[model samples]
Target chain A: MAHTSNYILGVYDDEDVLLKAIKNVREGGVKIHEVYSPFPVHGIDDVLGYKRSRLTIVAFLFGLLGTSLALTMQFGMMTIDWPMIIGGKDYAPVPSFIPVTFELTVLLASFGMVGTFMIISNLKPWGKAKLFDKRITDDKHIMAIDLGNNQLEESAIDKLLKDSGASEVNKKTL
Target chain B: MIAESAIREPLVTGGKTVHDVTEDISGRVEQKPTKTWMLAMAVSLATLAVGGYAVMRLVWDGIGMWGLNKTVGWAWDITNFVWWVGIGHAGTLISAILLLFRQRWRMSINRAAEAMTIFAVICAAMFPVLHMGRPWLGFYWALPLPNTFGSLWVNFNSPLLWDVFAISTYFSVSLVFWYIGLIPDFATIRDRATNKISAAVYGALSFGWDGAAKTWSRYETVALILAGLATPLVLSVHTIVSFDFATSVIPGWHTTIFPPYFVAGAIFSGFAMVLTLLIITRRVYKLEDYITLQHIELMNIVIIITGSIVGIAYITEFFIAWYSGVEAEQYAFINRATGPYAWAYWSMMTCNVISPQLFWRKKIRTNIAATFVISIIVNIGMWFERFVIIVTSLHRDFLPSSWAMFYPKWADVGVYIFTFGLFFTLFFAFAKFFPVINMAEVKSIVKATGEKKQA
Candidate 1:
């Protein structure tokens, strides 16, 4: 069950060139591995054909849990456990519960969303990252293609990348 | 050929390229601290020292060192607490609410503003904790934990307890959001690091961001969801704060208008503080290209709207007091405007209401000097607004026998001074170490124009 990824890294000086190159390469029946840039290139996700994220759905569920927890905790503490009168109101004031309920809902939703994002992205505190190219974090735009996934010849792929205005193309194994 | 009717100006001025964006922002981080930064830091540190001394005296000598009598127990401490909290509102509003609205102009200013939110909240929290007279126990007692105090739990019904949760959650969430935004920029700095130590430091801060398309896609999703959560959260934080007063039965403090009024006032003062800081920051860092004149103009428009809302709220308070036929309420309002504390009341009226009207003039709104002066004026007015609400209401209550005048001792002024020092000290350090402008978001705006130029 051992496997390795073979990648062809194409460096572009401009984002538009990279966008166009992505279209042309994909149209030529090549499956792109991934693209990296110092910043997000708009519409690149659609061109790369990524599905819409469901993080919002996760946030909603977390919010529901927080709301229930707040309600139950407040109800138990006030009416059941240490019921005392402060403002001469009911032991369990439903109106007073709303503010804490709202705050906890937001608190849990935000924390859950961030945690879910990190888990899905495979981000671990101590884990090492797979760096495609050093310059990709700088001004350069890099498009990495998996050579193992493609049936095209090596020279043909090289020619395809060079023809699409890549400043440099190199092969790397991960 | 179709003729374009109007041309939209670029968000980023100076026609900066992607490389230039990286260099301009990251270079500031990489370079040594400038002389201006040093001077500001020195002043902030000195103020911090003075404030620290005052806090020490207060803690050693008890809350009596402050000017809190039995009737006016919550004077400058609560006023300062609420003032700092209100000031923290603008950062989240700009970063979260504006982001949801697709305001691209926020890209330049959101980072610094978010930092301000964190620091301001820190300053805000300091007051309630220290005002407890025993801060060490107050921290733990504030939490609803299972303790050995005869199975006693915190009063969930108390708005002060709610504030403990609200401010802490706000500070933590803002920190995470700000740090998440910084990761890519941190990675950029990591890649460009000339020395090993710098690379390792920034590399760790980045949390191994490789900028993969899939990762970028998730990052964007998380940011949007956080913004969605924060928008309501920011509103609730202030609403809960207003509840601390509104839930009470005090004549001036008890009103349904407190929530909306406080919220509007928070945004008004927050934006003013943002303008005050950003104006100086833009000039100091030579970042006019990023923090453009248009940004200032748009923020001024928000100020005018919120300021008007606050002004109307002030008028409504008086009308309601008179219309309600409650003698205590009427007397409280009259006392605020014409009593012993009339000077503070007029200052609030003039600064919060009349001063912002100047922004209605297009010439003044766009003028940098005018905006700068008005921003400072608005903040001073906001401080007075909190003072007027807390002191004026509490000073003259139902019983004439209990009526007492509250005046702040030196410690009250000293603690407030301390917060300014703490805020600027943290801000100056942030400016020196981190990327002031968000390079990644700014780059997105330029991509469209950059493509046209490349063609």
Candidate 2:
């Protein structure tokens, strides 16, 4: 039984060096599992060739969903659930629904966006995540590679990281 | 990225490193409050004490404490509510909106704005709490507690209910947003803390953050999510406040434009308050390098746009009333322009609508003295806007017999003072505590801008 294990290959030094190393590794046809950073480096998505975020798509759909829900809830409540004539207006009043509808649309969309953001980001409320380099948040950049390939000799990977300007290289099996 | 960006040019042409940012901002906050902050605090406190006693007396004497009668049921209570609500807007802008836009300049001013938001909301909240007359029953309105009363559903549609929900939501969300951003910086202080008690206090708030890669990423995600949530909530909160008036039967009150008008006014005055604080803070904190003149320039542009929107709203109200040919609406406008509160109306116009135009000059927009004074003017103008709207409208209702001008009794004035004092007291304390700017975020932006920095 081959239980495939993923290893985190850390190339820790600075952004430019890490970027060059990652691109070199990718060009060498290495399949990376993930890259972690302390902060987002601009154009990194293109560098790693990651997919554009689907979060926006989800947000739009959720926003529409919210809008529909708000309009239905508001219109239905005023027009049907417990409609009372106020200020000589009719039982089903559109003008009066403006405030509630506006509020609800905002409420739902904002909530939906937040919920979607958290889910897509894969964040749990508690517990620290595994980190490649602690100092990446301060003054470092890091690239992580999964080291399951037979060709990916640990020495060669470490050599590649150093040659490409990695200040440090670490391999962790998790 | 840091090593790579080491080669990059700095954004502000020439700027300092992360260490410099820390030193500069800490230096800014470290100052003893200027004669100005002290003077303002003293004045606000005195006003509050005097006003607070008057209000207490009124509460004791019953509702007759104010000039409020059958016709003018709402007086300074509503005016103060509107003023405070308008004041709260700049905090949301500085934090949520600016964060979304990735504006680096936000760092210098956001602390003051967040403090302002918390304070202004406190001020706004006092009106409804006390105006309910049976002050103890205030909790009843927040009501339907499981123990005392059954879970009677709040009328989902009532603007008053919406105010309760919106105000509380704004307060809690702002607190979380402000606190979350402060945590890492708090950790920095914790590390630098000499006193054991100070270390413990900051350590608890900092949540053991060590600026690790995973921690920073998590912080960024959380901050973004919170900011995204807050942007619309900020808009909704004020819109709900506007609904308080728009839902009413009064001719001027019943309009579709109220939400946008109120929001614009809120943002306008909010920016003014921010300008006032940032000016003093930048000078006192010696944060001239961080909260640069450029930031003030950007704020001036916002103030002008919102100010213009308010001006348009004023014109649009006149146009709509004339176009609708509603006699009552026309009467409201006529009374506002020419009646007993005509001075208030004109003051609102000159201060809010007219003053923001001075920002067209780059020099004036960036000048701390000019911006500070304009902000104060805008704030005063906005207060009068609410006063004119509430007082003038209520003063002359549809019935001629019910027409009566409001003279804010000592109690009415006192409560307003107490509210401001409460706000300022909280603000002064907040300044004493937290790192007003998100140091981590600013460092990130500094890195992003690829500046050649020196600390």
Candidate 3:
């Protein structure tokens, strides 16, 4: 089931203008649902008041899981399950386990983080994407403000977007 | 005023605006292949044909087609393996390490370099598998798989087994990382597509990237984490590769210095390959303004540093061999420098050590022609380095009765030619199809200093 919503889309020609407009519209007490740009606008997250991502913490936990699994598997195989005397070394050599352990740690951490990111971003293989403007992926920057979240009238928000240097403003419904 | 003047030079030249950047980079992919590209592809395909014939013959015949005797079992096969693997390292360095260090200049070159890593690793992987006599079975046997053979499992202690895990992990992780970086660029391409097929193809590849700020935030975080994972991962890959030799009982192969030495040499050779490829790529594609001389100069500086480290490692190996007071070890070192394989040793020294010293001069480092020649020389030198280590040491071991000369058969030469064919063919296809430069990353850097005028 899809939840329909209304949004006022403001498009900007320049990133500088977009950056400035993000600040101006926010200061004017307008709620921004999302801002989209072709590339990362460095301070946009801070300007839009987004919290720092916890993906790194998740990556750390995943790394620990990888390390534990690798050590357990190696120790069990070399010492517990099949013990063969080779090169006059002990059956369970910790030093020898380092390479595989390290490789698995990296492998898991990378895959886990990407998986976490996909889930959190709602990026499913079969899910339909919400595209605001095709030009956002090319050269334009866009700001989409949800009508349900904003207290101001639609006309007032449209005037505010124009004053804040939006090249064009369009009403979008989904 | 002086300090302000010394503020870093602009990364992208020719005063390119954001729109111009999109046009310059994506246009290359969308445009019809030029006559030069067609000619180059034709030549590469011909080489591929020759290499293909060679590989087919090797598959038909057994490992006996190669001139490996009981004395020198491992030869050009392993040498080419290590050489190609080393060449793959520079790509990871440029893409992951430089990104972690926040070097903006990497933005322009990382895409091609990362592609080189994937292709070079593909070439490197063929040798170990093919050298196994029965590659079809050996591939599975190397893995620690559950099988019907009673109580038979992969030896956990073997460095060769470690290599199976390391190389595969490195390849998969690098592939994912490289593909992740390509998404936004693919989205850009998708939006710019004039035809339906192009749109559908690029659209699927981009995973429907909507350029939402929330998505961009997560994308940045993922890129950072991936870079962090890949930095140590790249170092470990080469270090593990060196263990395949360093853990052995052979005199020259067993050394405390192997890890660092191999890593440095890998970076040295890898940067050289990057330079070789980029020099031609920049010229043929007319990407002068994007991949500028500054990028070449910076990469050359890296070559000089890694080259010097490799040279130091070489000298240290000889000194340690002499100081160990073991006659066999001393003989191995002496033989490497003055024995039948002395020519190879000297070539390694000249190319790896002496040639890169030319970069110490600012003019030579910055000169495109000079950088190109030295890059090829350095790669040749690194190849000889591996050859010297494997062949020279194994040829004359403890038993003089069993000591013998190893020579390359037509199969040995052909397999290597096949890899070259494989690498160039894949690279040309990537160049023609994918965005050679990371357009989004470049756009970020250029936003502040990009050309204002529309190109």
Candidate 4:
């Protein structure tokens, strides 16, 4: 059976209040969905209990791949493919390959990291996003709690939000 | 958050709130282009048209259309290439290096400077590709591709080939870094758009950014790593460019100090160009509070430091030449100072070396008019620096019989004008459409350091 998804949206005028409210609401045993703000709030992720990101690992791996690919391409071409005596240097010339290797490593690491980030975050040109509150992109901080995911009743969640200093509480169904 | 030293001045003045930042920055994008903007665009387009014709003629006829002497195989084209590439360095230095240092002032200017980096790189690429004479054929040939030509690959031992890889990688990575920063700002504009078309366009540009804490956390991490990657990448790019000259056996070009010297000179020139444009941009867009006099003074200090480094490098070159006891190297330095191109050499000394020394005086550093004039002079001096390095070194070799003075043709001047046209056209378009200042960043800083601190 098809069902509607319900969310209780708590709008706050300032980030500090929203941050403190998040901790308070969590301690009140209500499961939170997400918090949206106009700008990145310092310590919001840690307060929300988000794990540290591993995108840097992805970048490091991609950087290694770039280094290998560059070396293989250069070595394969210079030595194995068609060895020549230009500039009176050796066939492979590893020292000379440093510049291209460095460039390629940076190129792939950044590209791979960003590409992975976009995919994981669902950031695409055509991707649709749920706009919880329009002011989330302006000055307001929005904390959206999925009613279906929480054990508490809708009224209880709304009361918790308001008591925790929400400027206004609204319900949204999608 | 680290408590910023109370002694320091605020990065963002005017007691702005988060809403005020969005309104002020996005307001320009939402409004129709001002008369002044249209006037600037018209001038840029007209210059582009003239430059475009020159390009078409050069392509239609040949590289012969350029004022290049066979004797000076690399003249204005190479000089312009090095000059433009050097100018691209400051953007990365501000965005990447300054970020690593946690210099908060960079937030205000990095977006525009990074945009300048991309545009400058594009202009820089034009000289070499066009210099190839048949760029349509020679462009791809420069790469190390598996080709139809029997078993022939690009020489890995060659610095010119390193340049091909370095420039391409630098351009691509800088574009990525700049765009990643823009996405959040673009989403801010997307959400604020009153019209559907503008909303859809900015939405696509923003790549559907959700302001969730998790996404933002990841975004910050990505930005830091990219900044880390780009710092060394920017350094490597200029080092490789210097390698193109230093690896050569020529007298002036064979110095060991070329890499550091070239890098310092690049930052000197790049900051000058940044100051020149930003001085004009801040006034035109009325962003005085964001790009304050403190920012200008800070950049002037960078000019003083890098400009002095460049000055020392110049003095070192002379010392090395005399100490090396190589007759050709000595002749090269002496010729540069007292020969036919002595005017250019002295101009480089006066503008790149002596002029920035004036910034040591606080009075001169903070004066906007003086900063603007000296910025222009610094760029002119940098252009001469490259010209002197390239032409004087090549003009007189051991062969006195083949030595000839280079005279630039109309095409040489026109093509240079073409790049200026292209750079400004791209820059003006960026200014009009994209958020010139990073609104999200400014908002974050405003929260921390704005005159009205949040409770």
Top lDDT: which candidate number? Answer: 4
lDDT of 4 at B404: 88
Query: B1-455, model 2: which lDDT tens digit per residue?
Result: 43334553333334666556555554434445667667767876776777788778867777788778787888788889989988998897788998899666676577678878878988888888888777886776653232245434334457787687678767777776776667656655655566787667766665555443333444455567668878988988888899889888897788899999999999999998888877776666566666776778889999999999999999999899889999999989988999988999999999988899999888889787888899999999999988887888888977898888787777777787788778776776666566666566666566556345456
Candidate order by TM-score, highest to lowest? 4, 3, 1, 2
TM-score of predicted structure 2: 0.79
* DockQ for the candidates, in order: 0.57, 0.15, 0.57, 0.81
lDDT to native, each model? 0.88, 0.71, 0.89, 0.91
Between the candidate structures 3 and 4, which one is better when assessed by lDDT?
A: 4
Candidate 4 backbone clash number? 0
- The estimated TM-scores of all candidates read 0.96, 0.79, 0.97, 0.98
Q: Candidate 3 at residue B348, lDDT?
A: 97
- Number of clashing residue pairs, candidate 3: 2
Q: What local lDDT score does residue B367 receive in model 2, on the 0 to 100 scale?
A: 81
The TM-score of candidate 3 is 0.97
Which candidate, 3 or 4, has the higher DockQ?
4
Question: How many clashes show up in model 2?
Answer: 7
- TM-score winner between candidates 1 and 2: 1
Residue ranges of candidate 1 with Cα displaced over 4 Å: A1-4, A124-127, B1-6, B449-455
Q: TM-score for candidate 4, please give it.
A: 0.98
Write down the RMSD of all candidates, one decimal each.
Answer: 2.5, 5.5, 2.2, 1.6
Interface RMSD of each: 3.2, 5.1, 3.2, 1.1
Among the numbered candidates, top TM-score falls to 4
Error of 4 at A68 (Å): 0.7
